[model samples]
Target: MLKKYSATPYVIWSILFIVIPLILIVTYSLSTKNPINGQLVFSFSNYRKFLELKFINVLLKSVTLAFKATIICIILGYPMAMILSKMEAKLQKKLIVLFILPMWMNFLMRTYAWMVILGKNGFINKLLSMVGLNLNLLYTRGAVLLGMVYNFLPFMVLPIFTVLLKIDNNYIEAAEDLGADKLTVFRKIIFPLSMPGLISGITMVFMPAVSTFVISNLLGGGKEVLIGNLIEQQFLVLNNWNFGSALSVILMIFILVFMAFINKFDKDNDDKGGVGLW
Candidate 1:
Protein backbone atom coordinates (compact mmCIF):
# COMPACT_ATOMS: atom_id res chain seq x y z
CA MET A 1 0.00 0.00 0.00
CA LEU A 2 2.84 2.40 0.83
CA LYS A 3 4.69 1.56 -2.37
CA LYS A 4 1.53 2.05 -4.42
CA TYR A 5 0.94 5.49 -2.92
CA SER A 6 4.51 6.67 -3.60
CA ALA A 7 4.46 5.41 -7.21
CA THR A 8 1.02 6.91 -7.90
CA PRO A 9 2.10 10.41 -6.83
CA TYR A 10 5.23 10.24 -9.04
CA VAL A 11 3.16 9.23 -12.07
CA ILE A 12 0.69 12.01 -11.46
CA TRP A 13 3.46 14.61 -11.04
CA SER A 14 5.39 13.45 -14.10
CA ILE A 15 2.35 13.66 -16.36
CA LEU A 16 1.04 16.94 -14.96
CA PHE A 17 4.36 18.84 -14.71
CA ILE A 18 7.39 17.40 -16.46
CA VAL A 19 6.17 15.22 -19.34
CA ILE A 20 3.30 17.41 -20.48
CA PRO A 21 5.30 20.65 -20.51
CA LEU A 22 8.22 19.01 -22.32
CA ILE A 23 5.83 17.82 -25.03
CA LEU A 24 4.39 21.30 -25.40
CA ILE A 25 7.86 22.90 -25.62
CA VAL A 26 8.98 20.44 -28.30
CA THR A 27 5.83 21.06 -30.29
CA TYR A 28 6.34 24.80 -29.96
CA SER A 29 9.96 24.60 -31.14
CA LEU A 30 9.06 22.91 -34.43
CA SER A 31 6.82 25.74 -35.49
CA THR A 32 6.86 28.86 -37.74
CA LYS A 33 5.25 32.27 -37.82
CA ASN A 34 2.09 33.15 -39.76
CA PRO A 35 2.46 36.56 -41.44
CA ILE A 36 -1.26 36.79 -42.15
CA ASN A 37 -2.57 36.44 -38.59
CA GLY A 38 0.72 36.92 -36.68
CA GLN A 39 0.39 33.49 -35.15
CA LEU A 40 2.83 30.61 -34.80
CA VAL A 41 2.45 28.15 -37.69
CA PHE A 42 3.43 24.50 -37.47
CA SER A 43 6.94 24.42 -39.03
CA PHE A 44 10.74 24.64 -38.21
CA SER A 45 11.66 28.28 -38.76
CA ASN A 46 11.80 28.95 -35.02
CA TYR A 47 14.67 26.50 -34.62
CA ARG A 48 16.37 27.93 -37.70
CA LYS A 49 16.26 31.38 -36.14
CA PHE A 50 17.63 29.96 -32.91
CA LEU A 51 20.65 28.71 -34.87
CA GLU A 52 21.48 32.22 -36.09
CA LEU A 53 24.60 34.26 -35.23
CA LYS A 54 22.96 36.77 -32.84
CA PHE A 55 21.43 34.12 -30.62
CA ILE A 56 24.62 32.07 -30.79
CA ASN A 57 26.59 35.07 -29.53
CA VAL A 58 24.24 35.42 -26.58
CA LEU A 59 24.62 31.73 -25.72
CA LEU A 60 28.38 32.02 -25.91
CA LYS A 61 28.41 35.07 -23.64
CA SER A 62 26.20 33.33 -21.10
CA VAL A 63 28.37 30.21 -21.05
CA THR A 64 31.52 32.26 -20.64
CA LEU A 65 30.11 34.23 -17.70
CA ALA A 66 28.91 31.04 -16.05
CA PHE A 67 32.33 29.46 -16.38
CA LYS A 68 33.96 32.54 -14.89
CA ALA A 69 31.59 32.51 -11.93
CA THR A 70 32.18 28.79 -11.29
CA ILE A 71 35.94 29.31 -11.29
CA ILE A 72 35.65 32.27 -8.91
CA CYS A 73 33.41 30.23 -6.59
CA ILE A 74 35.88 27.35 -6.52
CA ILE A 75 38.82 29.62 -5.79
CA LEU A 76 37.02 31.56 -3.06
CA GLY A 77 34.70 28.90 -1.65
CA TYR A 78 37.23 26.09 -1.21
CA PRO A 79 39.32 28.14 1.21
CA MET A 80 36.24 29.19 3.17
CA ALA A 81 35.09 25.55 3.35
CA MET A 82 38.51 24.50 4.53
CA ILE A 83 38.53 27.16 7.22
CA LEU A 84 35.06 26.20 8.38
CA SER A 85 36.00 22.52 8.50
CA LYS A 86 39.08 23.27 10.59
CA MET A 87 37.38 25.49 13.15
CA GLU A 88 35.92 24.52 16.55
CA ALA A 89 32.32 23.28 16.59
CA LYS A 90 30.80 26.41 18.14
CA LEU A 91 32.68 28.75 15.81
CA GLN A 92 31.91 26.55 12.83
CA LYS A 93 28.21 26.70 13.45
CA LYS A 94 28.34 30.48 13.87
CA LEU A 95 30.34 30.94 10.68
CA ILE A 96 28.06 28.62 8.74
CA VAL A 97 25.06 30.66 9.81
CA LEU A 98 26.79 33.85 8.81
CA PHE A 99 27.57 32.38 5.41
CA ILE A 100 23.99 31.23 4.85
CA LEU A 101 22.27 34.30 6.29
CA PRO A 102 22.60 36.27 3.07
CA MET A 103 20.56 33.64 1.28
CA TRP A 104 17.63 34.29 3.59
CA MET A 105 17.26 37.80 2.19
CA ASN A 106 15.37 38.26 -1.04
CA PHE A 107 17.69 37.79 -4.04
CA LEU A 108 16.48 40.96 -5.72
CA MET A 109 17.01 42.89 -2.54
CA ARG A 110 20.57 41.67 -2.22
CA THR A 111 21.17 42.49 -5.88
CA TYR A 112 19.78 45.98 -5.39
CA ALA A 113 22.06 46.39 -2.39
CA TRP A 114 25.03 45.66 -4.63
CA MET A 115 23.73 48.22 -7.08
CA VAL A 116 23.73 50.78 -4.29
CA ILE A 117 27.33 49.92 -3.45
CA LEU A 118 28.65 49.77 -7.00
CA GLY A 119 26.65 52.35 -8.89
CA LYS A 120 28.42 55.57 -10.05
CA ASN A 121 26.92 57.53 -7.20
CA GLY A 122 27.02 54.47 -4.94
CA PHE A 123 29.14 53.65 -1.92
CA ILE A 124 32.37 52.57 -3.57
CA ASN A 125 32.41 55.46 -6.00
CA LYS A 126 31.55 57.95 -3.27
CA LEU A 127 34.39 56.69 -1.12
CA LEU A 128 36.80 56.87 -4.03
CA SER A 129 35.78 60.41 -4.83
CA MET A 130 36.35 61.45 -1.22
CA VAL A 131 39.96 60.30 -1.59
CA GLY A 132 40.52 61.66 -5.11
CA LEU A 133 39.94 58.32 -6.88
CA ASN A 134 37.30 57.40 -9.41
CA LEU A 135 35.71 54.16 -10.63
CA ASN A 136 32.79 53.19 -12.81
CA LEU A 137 31.21 49.91 -11.69
CA LEU A 138 27.55 50.15 -12.44
CA TYR A 139 26.28 48.83 -15.78
CA THR A 140 29.53 46.92 -16.36
CA ARG A 141 30.40 43.28 -16.98
CA GLY A 142 32.44 43.28 -13.78
CA ALA A 143 29.38 44.27 -11.77
CA VAL A 144 27.44 41.40 -13.30
CA LEU A 145 30.22 38.96 -12.39
CA LEU A 146 30.35 40.29 -8.85
CA GLY A 147 26.58 39.96 -8.49
CA MET A 148 26.66 36.35 -9.69
CA VAL A 149 29.44 35.47 -7.29
CA TYR A 150 27.74 37.22 -4.37
CA ASN A 151 24.45 35.47 -5.05
CA PHE A 152 25.82 31.97 -5.70
CA LEU A 153 28.63 31.83 -3.11
CA PRO A 154 26.43 30.21 -0.47
CA PHE A 155 25.36 27.42 -2.80
CA MET A 156 29.00 26.65 -3.59
CA VAL A 157 30.10 26.78 0.05
CA LEU A 158 27.39 24.55 1.60
CA PRO A 159 28.07 21.50 -0.57
CA ILE A 160 31.82 21.80 -0.22
CA PHE A 161 31.58 22.24 3.56
CA THR A 162 29.43 19.11 3.81
CA VAL A 163 31.99 17.07 1.88
CA LEU A 164 34.86 18.47 3.94
CA LEU A 165 33.16 17.54 7.18
CA LYS A 166 32.63 13.98 5.98
CA ILE A 167 36.34 13.51 5.17
CA ASP A 168 38.11 11.08 7.49
CA ASN A 169 40.57 12.84 9.75
CA ASN A 170 42.50 9.57 9.96
CA TYR A 171 43.72 10.21 6.44
CA ILE A 172 45.42 13.45 7.47
CA GLU A 173 46.93 11.83 10.57
CA ALA A 174 48.29 8.92 8.58
CA ALA A 175 49.79 11.23 5.98
CA GLU A 176 51.53 13.17 8.72
CA ASP A 177 52.70 9.96 10.38
CA LEU A 178 54.34 9.01 7.09
CA GLY A 179 56.20 12.38 7.05
CA ALA A 180 53.86 13.88 4.46
CA ASP A 181 53.72 17.65 4.57
CA LYS A 182 50.42 19.55 4.87
CA LEU A 183 50.53 20.50 1.20
CA THR A 184 51.19 16.91 0.17
CA VAL A 185 48.28 15.58 2.24
CA PHE A 186 45.91 18.16 0.83
CA ARG A 187 47.04 17.73 -2.78
CA LYS A 188 46.90 13.91 -2.78
CA ILE A 189 44.18 13.06 -0.31
CA ILE A 190 41.83 15.91 0.60
CA PHE A 191 41.37 17.31 -2.91
CA PRO A 192 40.51 13.98 -4.52
CA LEU A 193 38.15 13.13 -1.69
CA SER A 194 36.23 16.35 -2.24
CA MET A 195 35.75 15.83 -5.99
CA PRO A 196 32.05 14.98 -5.72
CA GLY A 197 31.29 18.12 -3.76
CA LEU A 198 33.39 20.23 -6.08
CA ILE A 199 31.55 18.84 -9.09
CA SER A 200 28.18 19.48 -7.46
CA GLY A 201 29.16 23.01 -6.43
CA ILE A 202 30.31 23.76 -9.97
CA THR A 203 26.96 22.59 -11.32
CA MET A 204 25.04 24.60 -8.76
CA VAL A 205 26.93 27.79 -9.54
CA PHE A 206 27.22 27.38 -13.30
CA MET A 207 23.60 26.58 -14.20
CA PRO A 208 22.01 29.58 -12.51
CA ALA A 209 24.82 31.99 -13.42
CA VAL A 210 24.31 31.19 -17.08
CA SER A 211 20.52 31.30 -16.99
CA THR A 212 20.15 34.46 -14.89
CA PHE A 213 18.89 37.49 -16.77
CA VAL A 214 18.15 39.88 -13.94
CA ILE A 215 21.74 40.31 -12.78
CA SER A 216 22.91 40.97 -16.31
CA ASN A 217 20.13 43.45 -16.90
CA LEU A 218 20.35 45.37 -13.62
CA LEU A 219 24.09 45.26 -12.99
CA GLY A 220 25.29 44.98 -16.57
CA GLY A 221 23.07 47.93 -17.55
CA GLY A 222 21.46 46.04 -20.43
CA LYS A 223 24.81 45.98 -22.25
CA GLU A 224 25.83 42.49 -21.21
CA VAL A 225 23.00 40.40 -22.58
CA LEU A 226 22.92 36.62 -22.05
CA ILE A 227 20.97 33.70 -23.52
CA GLY A 228 18.32 34.18 -20.84
CA ASN A 229 17.93 37.81 -21.81
CA LEU A 230 17.51 36.83 -25.43
CA ILE A 231 14.90 34.24 -24.55
CA GLU A 232 13.01 36.78 -22.46
CA GLN A 233 13.20 39.29 -25.28
CA GLN A 234 11.96 36.77 -27.78
CA PHE A 235 8.98 35.97 -25.62
CA LEU A 236 8.06 39.48 -24.47
CA VAL A 237 9.40 42.08 -26.88
CA LEU A 238 9.44 40.18 -30.17
CA ASN A 239 6.24 38.32 -29.29
CA ASN A 240 7.86 35.19 -30.71
CA TRP A 241 6.95 32.40 -28.37
CA ASN A 242 8.12 29.69 -30.73
CA PHE A 243 11.62 31.13 -31.00
CA GLY A 244 11.83 31.62 -27.24
CA SER A 245 10.74 28.03 -26.66
CA ALA A 246 13.37 26.82 -29.13
CA LEU A 247 16.06 28.78 -27.32
CA SER A 248 14.96 27.33 -24.00
CA VAL A 249 15.20 23.86 -25.55
CA ILE A 250 18.74 24.65 -26.73
CA LEU A 251 19.75 25.92 -23.29
CA MET A 252 18.35 22.80 -21.63
CA ILE A 253 20.20 20.62 -24.15
CA PHE A 254 23.44 22.46 -23.41
CA ILE A 255 23.04 21.92 -19.64
CA LEU A 256 22.20 18.23 -20.17
CA VAL A 257 25.33 17.79 -22.29
CA PHE A 258 27.52 19.40 -19.63
CA MET A 259 25.99 17.24 -16.89
CA ALA A 260 26.63 14.16 -19.04
CA PHE A 261 30.25 15.17 -19.51
CA ILE A 262 30.76 15.64 -15.76
CA ASN A 263 29.15 12.26 -15.00
CA LYS A 264 31.17 10.48 -17.69
CA PHE A 265 34.48 11.91 -16.56
CA ASP A 266 33.90 11.39 -12.81
CA LYS A 267 32.51 7.85 -13.13
CA ASP A 268 35.65 6.01 -12.07
CA ASN A 269 35.62 7.07 -8.43
CA ASP A 270 33.66 5.17 -5.80
CA ASP A 271 33.83 6.76 -2.33
CA LYS A 272 32.34 3.94 -0.32
CA GLY A 273 35.69 2.75 1.04
CA GLY A 274 37.21 4.77 3.89
CA VAL A 275 40.93 4.31 3.36
CA GLY A 276 43.27 6.74 5.11
CA LEU A 277 46.22 8.20 3.26
CA TRP A 278 49.77 6.87 3.79
Candidate 2:
Protein backbone atom coordinates (compact mmCIF):
# COMPACT_ATOMS: atom_id res chain seq x y z
CA MET A 1 0.00 0.00 0.00
CA LEU A 2 2.82 2.39 0.89
CA LYS A 3 4.74 1.63 -2.30
CA LYS A 4 1.64 2.24 -4.43
CA TYR A 5 0.99 5.53 -2.72
CA SER A 6 4.66 6.50 -3.09
CA ALA A 7 4.06 6.62 -6.88
CA THR A 8 1.24 9.11 -6.37
CA PRO A 9 3.51 12.14 -6.39
CA TYR A 10 5.18 11.07 -9.63
CA VAL A 11 1.77 10.41 -11.16
CA ILE A 12 0.58 13.83 -10.08
CA TRP A 13 3.71 15.45 -11.48
CA SER A 14 3.27 13.77 -14.83
CA ILE A 15 -0.37 14.77 -14.98
CA LEU A 16 0.34 18.38 -14.13
CA PHE A 17 3.33 18.81 -16.40
CA ILE A 18 3.31 16.28 -19.22
CA VAL A 19 -0.33 15.35 -19.61
CA ILE A 20 -1.74 18.85 -19.19
CA PRO A 21 0.73 20.43 -21.62
CA LEU A 22 0.05 17.76 -24.24
CA ILE A 23 -3.69 18.26 -23.81
CA LEU A 24 -3.33 22.01 -24.26
CA ILE A 25 -1.24 21.57 -27.41
CA VAL A 26 -3.78 19.18 -28.88
CA THR A 27 -6.69 21.46 -28.03
CA TYR A 28 -4.99 24.46 -29.53
CA SER A 29 -4.00 22.48 -32.64
CA LEU A 30 -7.63 21.55 -33.31
CA SER A 31 -8.91 25.09 -32.82
CA THR A 32 -8.80 28.39 -34.70
CA LYS A 33 -8.98 32.06 -33.79
CA ASN A 34 -12.13 33.86 -34.89
CA PRO A 35 -11.53 36.50 -37.56
CA ILE A 36 -14.39 38.78 -36.45
CA ASN A 37 -14.69 38.54 -32.61
CA GLY A 38 -11.23 37.11 -31.65
CA GLN A 39 -12.65 33.93 -30.13
CA LEU A 40 -11.14 30.41 -30.59
CA VAL A 41 -13.31 28.08 -32.65
CA PHE A 42 -12.92 24.32 -33.12
CA SER A 43 -11.48 23.69 -36.57
CA PHE A 44 -8.99 21.55 -38.59
CA SER A 45 -7.72 24.44 -40.69
CA ASN A 46 -4.39 24.54 -38.90
CA TYR A 47 -3.60 20.95 -39.83
CA ARG A 48 -4.88 21.49 -43.34
CA LYS A 49 -2.55 24.41 -43.84
CA PHE A 50 0.47 22.23 -43.14
CA LEU A 51 -0.25 20.28 -46.30
CA GLU A 52 1.03 23.21 -48.37
CA LEU A 53 4.16 22.65 -50.52
CA LYS A 54 6.39 25.06 -48.58
CA PHE A 55 5.78 23.27 -45.28
CA ILE A 56 6.25 19.87 -46.92
CA ASN A 57 9.62 21.00 -48.34
CA VAL A 58 10.72 22.17 -44.92
CA LEU A 59 9.78 18.83 -43.37
CA LEU A 60 11.68 16.95 -46.10
CA LYS A 61 14.80 19.04 -45.67
CA SER A 62 14.73 18.49 -41.90
CA VAL A 63 14.46 14.72 -42.33
CA THR A 64 17.16 14.56 -45.00
CA LEU A 65 19.66 16.58 -42.95
CA ALA A 66 18.91 14.62 -39.79
CA PHE A 67 19.32 11.34 -41.64
CA LYS A 68 22.68 12.44 -42.99
CA ALA A 69 23.90 13.38 -39.53
CA THR A 70 22.75 10.08 -38.01
CA ILE A 71 24.51 8.12 -40.73
CA ILE A 72 27.73 10.06 -40.27
CA CYS A 73 27.59 9.55 -36.50
CA ILE A 74 27.17 5.79 -36.92
CA ILE A 75 30.07 5.57 -39.36
CA LEU A 76 32.40 7.58 -37.14
CA GLY A 77 31.19 6.34 -33.75
CA TYR A 78 31.24 2.58 -34.47
CA PRO A 79 34.99 2.55 -35.04
CA MET A 80 35.63 4.72 -31.99
CA ALA A 81 33.48 2.45 -29.81
CA MET A 82 35.23 -0.65 -31.10
CA ILE A 83 38.61 0.87 -30.32
CA LEU A 84 37.49 1.98 -26.85
CA SER A 85 36.05 -1.46 -26.10
CA LYS A 86 39.47 -2.97 -26.83
CA MET A 87 41.34 -0.59 -24.51
CA GLU A 88 42.46 -1.40 -20.97
CA ALA A 89 39.51 -0.99 -18.61
CA LYS A 90 41.22 1.81 -16.66
CA LEU A 91 42.16 3.78 -19.77
CA GLN A 92 38.64 3.23 -21.20
CA LYS A 93 37.02 4.88 -18.21
CA LYS A 94 39.29 7.94 -18.41
CA LEU A 95 38.76 8.33 -22.16
CA ILE A 96 35.00 7.93 -21.81
CA VAL A 97 34.98 10.67 -19.19
CA LEU A 98 37.04 12.90 -21.47
CA PHE A 99 34.60 12.30 -24.33
CA ILE A 100 31.61 13.11 -22.13
CA LEU A 101 33.13 16.15 -20.43
CA PRO A 102 32.14 18.46 -23.30
CA MET A 103 28.53 17.36 -22.85
CA TRP A 104 28.56 18.71 -19.29
CA MET A 105 28.65 22.23 -20.76
CA ASN A 106 25.49 23.86 -22.01
CA PHE A 107 24.69 22.67 -25.57
CA LEU A 108 24.03 26.23 -26.67
CA MET A 109 27.49 27.21 -25.57
CA ARG A 110 28.95 24.27 -27.44
CA THR A 111 27.13 25.32 -30.63
CA TYR A 112 28.39 28.86 -30.21
CA ALA A 113 31.94 27.60 -29.84
CA TRP A 114 31.59 25.88 -33.21
CA MET A 115 30.56 29.22 -34.69
CA VAL A 116 33.93 30.66 -33.63
CA ILE A 117 35.79 27.71 -35.11
CA LEU A 118 33.91 27.64 -38.42
CA GLY A 119 33.43 31.36 -39.11
CA LYS A 120 35.13 32.88 -42.18
CA ASN A 121 37.72 34.65 -40.01
CA GLY A 122 37.73 31.74 -37.57
CA PHE A 123 40.53 29.36 -36.58
CA ILE A 124 40.16 26.94 -39.48
CA ASN A 125 40.12 29.67 -42.08
CA LYS A 126 43.11 31.43 -40.50
CA LEU A 127 45.07 28.17 -40.48
CA LEU A 128 44.18 27.56 -44.12
CA SER A 129 45.08 31.12 -45.09
CA MET A 130 48.58 30.56 -43.67
CA VAL A 131 48.86 27.58 -46.08
CA GLY A 132 47.83 29.86 -49.02
CA LEU A 133 44.37 28.29 -49.25
CA ASN A 134 41.15 29.99 -48.24
CA LEU A 135 37.90 28.15 -47.68
CA ASN A 136 34.37 29.20 -46.84
CA LEU A 137 33.65 27.05 -43.80
CA LEU A 138 30.74 28.68 -41.98
CA TYR A 139 27.02 29.31 -42.43
CA THR A 140 26.47 26.32 -44.69
CA ARG A 141 24.75 22.93 -44.69
CA GLY A 142 28.09 21.23 -44.06
CA ALA A 143 28.70 23.38 -41.01
CA VAL A 144 25.29 22.53 -39.57
CA LEU A 145 25.93 18.84 -40.24
CA LEU A 146 29.30 19.10 -38.50
CA GLY A 147 27.67 20.70 -35.46
CA MET A 148 25.00 17.99 -35.29
CA VAL A 149 27.63 15.25 -35.52
CA TYR A 150 29.87 16.81 -32.90
CA ASN A 151 27.06 17.28 -30.40
CA PHE A 152 25.49 13.83 -30.91
CA LEU A 153 28.50 11.61 -31.61
CA PRO A 154 28.92 10.82 -27.93
CA PHE A 155 25.36 9.55 -27.77
CA MET A 156 26.22 7.07 -30.53
CA VAL A 157 29.60 6.06 -29.13
CA LEU A 158 28.59 5.52 -25.50
CA PRO A 159 25.70 3.17 -26.21
CA ILE A 160 27.73 1.09 -28.66
CA PHE A 161 30.67 0.94 -26.25
CA THR A 162 28.40 -0.23 -23.45
CA VAL A 163 26.96 -3.00 -25.63
CA LEU A 164 30.39 -4.04 -26.87
CA LEU A 165 31.75 -4.22 -23.32
CA LYS A 166 28.86 -6.43 -22.29
CA ILE A 167 29.52 -8.94 -25.10
CA ASP A 168 31.30 -12.13 -24.01
CA ASN A 169 34.84 -12.62 -25.32
CA ASN A 170 34.09 -16.34 -25.36
CA TYR A 171 31.93 -15.85 -28.47
CA ILE A 172 34.88 -14.43 -30.39
CA GLU A 173 37.28 -17.06 -29.05
CA ALA A 174 34.90 -19.86 -29.98
CA ALA A 175 34.64 -18.54 -33.52
CA GLU A 176 38.45 -18.32 -33.76
CA ASP A 177 38.78 -21.87 -32.47
CA LEU A 178 36.49 -22.95 -35.28
CA GLY A 179 39.01 -21.42 -37.72
CA ALA A 180 37.10 -18.18 -38.34
CA ASP A 181 38.96 -14.98 -39.18
CA LYS A 182 38.61 -11.84 -37.05
CA LEU A 183 36.41 -10.17 -39.63
CA THR A 184 34.18 -13.24 -39.83
CA VAL A 185 33.85 -13.42 -36.05
CA PHE A 186 32.97 -9.75 -35.82
CA ARG A 187 30.47 -9.97 -38.67
CA LYS A 188 28.79 -13.04 -37.21
CA ILE A 189 28.87 -12.32 -33.48
CA ILE A 190 30.01 -8.83 -32.41
CA PHE A 191 28.05 -6.84 -34.97
CA PRO A 192 24.80 -8.70 -34.36
CA LEU A 193 25.06 -8.31 -30.58
CA SER A 194 25.68 -4.58 -30.93
CA MET A 195 22.52 -3.88 -32.95
CA PRO A 196 20.48 -2.87 -29.90
CA GLY A 197 23.00 -0.22 -28.94
CA LEU A 198 23.37 1.02 -32.51
CA ILE A 199 19.62 1.40 -32.78
CA SER A 200 19.55 3.33 -29.49
CA GLY A 201 22.34 5.59 -30.73
CA ILE A 202 20.51 6.26 -33.97
CA THR A 203 17.40 7.24 -32.03
CA MET A 204 19.37 9.49 -29.70
CA VAL A 205 21.17 11.24 -32.53
CA PHE A 206 18.37 11.44 -35.09
CA MET A 207 15.60 12.88 -32.90
CA PRO A 208 17.56 15.94 -31.77
CA ALA A 209 19.01 16.52 -35.23
CA VAL A 210 15.53 16.44 -36.68
CA SER A 211 14.12 18.98 -34.22
CA THR A 212 17.11 21.26 -33.64
CA PHE A 213 16.68 24.99 -34.22
CA VAL A 214 19.76 26.30 -32.46
CA ILE A 215 22.46 24.56 -34.49
CA SER A 216 20.71 25.55 -37.70
CA ASN A 217 20.20 29.09 -36.54
CA LEU A 218 23.82 29.57 -35.54
CA LEU A 219 25.60 27.48 -38.17
CA GLY A 220 23.08 27.60 -41.03
CA GLY A 221 22.75 31.38 -40.71
CA GLY A 222 19.26 32.32 -42.03
CA LYS A 223 19.95 30.52 -45.28
CA GLU A 224 18.85 27.17 -43.85
CA VAL A 225 15.55 26.81 -42.01
CA LEU A 226 14.08 23.61 -40.63
CA ILE A 227 10.68 22.53 -39.37
CA GLY A 228 11.69 23.48 -35.83
CA ASN A 229 12.44 27.06 -36.95
CA LEU A 230 9.12 27.17 -38.73
CA ILE A 231 7.28 26.11 -35.57
CA GLU A 232 9.18 28.62 -33.47
CA GLN A 233 8.32 31.41 -35.91
CA GLN A 234 4.65 30.46 -35.81
CA PHE A 235 4.50 30.56 -32.01
CA LEU A 236 6.83 33.34 -30.84
CA VAL A 237 7.22 35.50 -33.93
CA LEU A 238 3.92 35.12 -35.79
CA ASN A 239 1.75 34.58 -32.67
CA ASN A 240 -0.23 31.88 -34.45
CA TRP A 241 -0.69 29.58 -31.50
CA ASN A 242 -3.09 27.24 -33.28
CA PHE A 243 -0.78 26.81 -36.27
CA GLY A 244 2.24 26.35 -34.03
CA SER A 245 0.43 23.72 -32.03
CA ALA A 246 -0.51 21.96 -35.24
CA LEU A 247 3.12 21.92 -36.41
CA SER A 248 4.22 20.62 -33.02
CA VAL A 249 1.65 17.86 -33.31
CA ILE A 250 2.96 16.95 -36.76
CA LEU A 251 6.57 16.84 -35.56
CA MET A 252 5.55 14.64 -32.61
CA ILE A 253 3.76 12.27 -34.96
CA PHE A 254 6.81 12.10 -37.27
CA ILE A 255 9.08 11.22 -34.35
CA LEU A 256 6.67 8.57 -33.07
CA VAL A 257 6.30 6.99 -36.47
CA PHE A 258 10.06 6.96 -37.07
CA MET A 259 10.68 5.38 -33.67
CA ALA A 260 8.05 2.75 -34.33
CA PHE A 261 9.61 1.94 -37.67
CA ILE A 262 13.07 1.62 -36.11
CA ASN A 263 11.69 -0.63 -33.36
CA LYS A 264 10.00 -2.89 -35.87
CA PHE A 265 13.12 -3.07 -38.03
CA ASP A 266 15.32 -3.87 -35.03
CA LYS A 267 12.98 -6.68 -33.99
CA ASP A 268 12.94 -8.09 -37.48
CA ASN A 269 16.74 -8.02 -37.73
CA ASP A 270 17.06 -9.64 -34.28
CA ASP A 271 14.66 -12.41 -35.26
CA LYS A 272 16.77 -13.10 -38.33
CA GLY A 273 20.00 -13.14 -36.30
CA GLY A 274 21.01 -9.85 -37.95
CA VAL A 275 23.47 -9.87 -40.86
CA GLY A 276 24.82 -13.26 -41.86
CA LEU A 277 28.56 -13.74 -41.98
CA TRP A 278 28.20 -16.48 -44.61
Where is model 2 poorest over a 10-residue stretch in terms of lDDT?
269-278
Give each model a TM-score.
0.93, 0.94
Which pairs of residues collide in candidate 2? none
Mind giving the per-residue lDDT tens digits that candidate 1 earns over 21-60?
Answer: 9998888888877789977678877777767655787888
Instruction: Give candidate 1's error at residue 49 in angstroms.
Output: 1.3
Per-model RMSD to reference: 2.8, 3.1
Q: Which model scores highest in lDDT?
A: 2
Query: Over 4 Å off in model 2, which ranges?
Result: 269-278
In candidate 2, what are the lDDT values of residues 1-278, reduced to their tens digit? 99999999999999999999999999999999998999999999998899964698999999999999999999999999999999998998999999999999999999999999988889998999998987888889999999999999999999898888888888888999999998999898899888888998999999999999988999999789999899889898999999999999999999999999999868987786543211
Candidate 1 segments whose C-alpha is farther than 4 A from its true place: 37-40, 271-278
- Top model by TM-score, which number? 2
